[model samples]
Target chain A: MIRQFGLPEALAILSGVQATILLSLIAFVGGGVVGLAVALMRTSERTWLQRCAGFYIDFFQGTPLLMQLFLVFYGLPVLGYKVNPWIAVAIGFTLHASAFLGEIWRGSIQAVPRGQTEAAYALGLSYASRMRNVVLPQAMRISVAPTVGFMVQLIKGTSLAAIIGFVELSRAAQIIASATYKPLLAYGCAAIVYFVLCFPLSRLSMRLEKRFAVKT
Target chain B: MTYQFDFSVLLPYWEQLLRGCWLTILLSAISISAGLTIGILTALAKRSRFTTARIAAGTYVEIIRNTPFLVQVFFIFFGLPALGISFQPWSAAILALSLNCGAFSAEVIRGGIDAIARGQYEAGTALGLKPLQIFRHIVLKPALRIIFPALSGQFVLTLLTTSIVSSISAEELTSIAQSIDTLTFRSFEIYIVATILYLTMSFGFATLFKLIDRVYFSYPVK
Candidate 1:
């Protein structure tokens, strides 16, 4: 028997917002940490480090996220590590996020005026202190808009975990849709929920971009 | 680790993989062209004098931009059927991809158009050009030149996104890899191959776009 598309069904799908948010948060924070290192590496003086970082960014950016998730989901087992969908999806998203964030930040870092770096060097600041005190703060300011923009992508991307059977919002909708035989209502509700979640961030990104564009 | 990596098992399925890649290219090509058309029209509509047209186009861009493509695909492929508007998987995939691409490229194209100086339009008017002629001669080319890199980048993204249509049972590389995985139980190997194929295709397209940029957009306009 097909279940009616009722409030209860809607609530069940809405419940998935938590997992989606959690996954996006985890990926963002994790990716941010690794991505910083990547950005630093890309901007570093060492050519080898830069090349390695470049290759990492290129590899991740060039391939599809689904394939990345599949690799982790399936490849982990062959290496004798027990894997669950959550672990696999988390790893995949983190790696994917790192590369993208890294590239974004690398540009921001380079965009910091060359004169500032020269002044930092002339002031006897160490490389670490120069970057920590002089460069990163400025780069962070320039990066806020794009980073937030990327957050919108990250949130939408969390929906892909559904394909790997991760029980996120999209998967939840799939369950409800299949059960209720009301695919239209189920998917439509899911789309609205996603819009509710994403539209604000998109606006904020654009606003931040405008604000920064004027100041810079 | 006792498991032996056996990529050899996938060797027999190379032809299927090739076919999958071809279909993916075909899907992306059709969607990109359709999307560019939709994008140009929507971008123009958004900038039109009529408030209704502007609002309608704005709303379409926002709705598509804010939602995930997968949900869009699901809505189009499965949900539409409930309303007696069913489509073949391939048709649904193309429609969803084009719509998604259209929304994104509309923004890009609008930005391009907006970047053209107001004087350029006035200059066209002073030259006795019709409005359509003004847009074609004065606005469109420069705007396209400015946005070409971004547009091509979006196209590459659309190419990558075609993989997601597999969920609706649209025949593509990811779907083919999934089928091969079922047949050979070599999920890792199959996916790795698929990933490499995707990487190559994206890189190839990026290179091709760069070449187009150099050949067509390189000339300095007087």
Candidate 2:
């Protein structure tokens, strides 16, 4: 079966590995920044501000990203604004990642000891100063493993973009599978590529867990 | 420049949409139950003393975790047919969703089981209980109690993910919405309604899980 398959066809499917990598990068960085803001808003003192953040997170996280992506990629045109599939995919994935990453980071931030915040307050530091100088610094340590862990989810989630007709690795594999009439080989290679992308992160997450455990 | 929002156009198809929702519900329920069993077994395998068992369990988890559910569905729906195992869209979708949920649930359960104190297991052994009895009565029951919340969380995640099966034409809520969109050209309204439906379903399931947890666990949570 292996010898029967042509190399060029497999290479065609493999080429889209770059798109998968790019999709993950955009979601990771974009979601990271937005997630930090949402996490801050979630912990804010203002009631409405906290509620707004809560709604934002719940709405995005509760519903499926597939629907969200369709609504963006398709719904936007109905609203008189049309963008390319890639932009819609990015927006959809970025919003989805932000909600999850926000919650994860919030847990990490809250996991920091209450004593640390009290100490910062006693030192006459402002709320902003406390978060910037003390709370965030400590939370970063607890956040490493989970954040890296989520990258695996974010990367895998990008495969949903294929539904809207964006040609990512999975989509490319679908195309090749159709052309070559070799669904198993094409998809097997695609799955292997995804594994290659995600396996290292899984190992890194475990290592971080151990490294962080020793300190705590 | 006024476009009046029209929903009456969708009225006639309400029953069809409802049927689709029911399918989605049934698909998710079956996947959740089946996935939970597979997850617990895999989690146990990963933690077993046998190296082959650990590797097999770990490989299943890593493959499922890394790949998208959409791709997995495609592989099963399209690829398996080549290997002479034919599956309808519904069965393939359920299989893929269950596999995906199994991986995540295994990790959550493994965490819960691993968090158990060694003293508890030691006490079970010292009580002259068989290893299998100790596992069933001592290890698993307590582990399920601790991990119930995480397990429910994964179930909700699985519900959200079932939308991907729509791509393979499983006729779930999202697929029904797609047809409605084609007919009425009200993409935003149709999707907005679908989005609300999804949110409501997810919240409803979460609440139901909470009630189940309360009734079954009966451990007053702080």
C-alpha TM-scores of all predictions: 0.98, 0.94
True contacts kept of each: 0.89, 0.74
C-alpha DockQ for predicted model 1: 0.88
lDDT of 1 by residue, B41-107 (tens): 9999999999999999999999998888999999999999998999999999999999999999999
Writing each residue's lDDT as its tens digit, candidate 1 over A65-128 gives: 8888888889988889997778888888999999999999999999999999999999999999
Candidates, DockQ: 0.88, 0.69
Q: Write down the worst ten-residue block by lDDT for model 1 chain B.
A: B213-222
- After superposition, candidate 1 runs with Cα above 4 Å error: none
Q: After superposition, how far is residue A101 of candidate 2 from its true place, in Å?
A: 1.5
Docking class of 1: high
Tens digit per residue, CA lDDT, model 2, A1-216: 233458988888889888989988998889999999999999888999899999999999789898888778876666666688778788888888999999999899989999999999999999999999999999998999999999988888888888888998999998888887889988988998888898899889989989998987
Model 2: lDDT of residue B23: 78
**Interface C-alpha RMSD per candidate, 1 decimal:** 0.8, 1.5
- The candidate that achieves the highest lDDT relative to the unseen native structure: 1
True lDDT of residue A121, candidate 2: 91
In Å, residue B26's CA in model 2 sits off its true spot by 0.6
